[model samples]
Target: MNATIILVGTELLSGMTIDTNSIYMAEELNKYGIEIKYKFTVGDNIKDIVEVIEFGKDKSDLVILSGGLG
Candidate 1:
């Protein structure tokens, strides 16, 4: 299956914090034969996060979001 990954964090956009979750998840998913069609780094905005997820949903079979929980 194909998937899209959305990494949400203001720190990510500002480069203050490095994102390792997406990379790790990507590797694990790859081992299962899941192809990642898109990877997006969005700031900690609810609207932006939802927008990306909606876009990914339309373009891929699965949309996975990580971070921005604080």
Candidate 2:
């Protein structure tokens, strides 16, 4: 299956924090024969999150969102 990974966090966009989560998830998904079609890093904005998810759904069979949840 094709997948899109969306990492949400201001620190990620600012480059203050490394996006280790995406790399880890990608590796794990790869084991399952899942192809990562797209990867996006956006700040903590609901609008941006919604937009990316909407876009990802059209391009991928699965959408994986991580981080930015408190």
RMSD of each: 1.5, 1.7
Q: Give each model's whole-structure lDDT.
A: 0.91, 0.93
* Backbone-clash count (model 2): 0
Worst 10 residues of 2 by lDDT: 61-70
Q: Can you give the lDDT of residue 29 in candidate 1? A: 95
Off by over 4 Å in 2: none
Backbone clash pairs for candidate 1 read: none
Model 2 residue pairs with clashes: none
Best candidate (score: lDDT): 2
The 10-residue segment of model 1 with minimum total lDDT is: 61-70
All candidates' TM-scores?
0.92, 0.93
lDDT of 1 by residue, 1-70 (tens): 9999999889898888888898899999999999999999999788998999999999999999899543
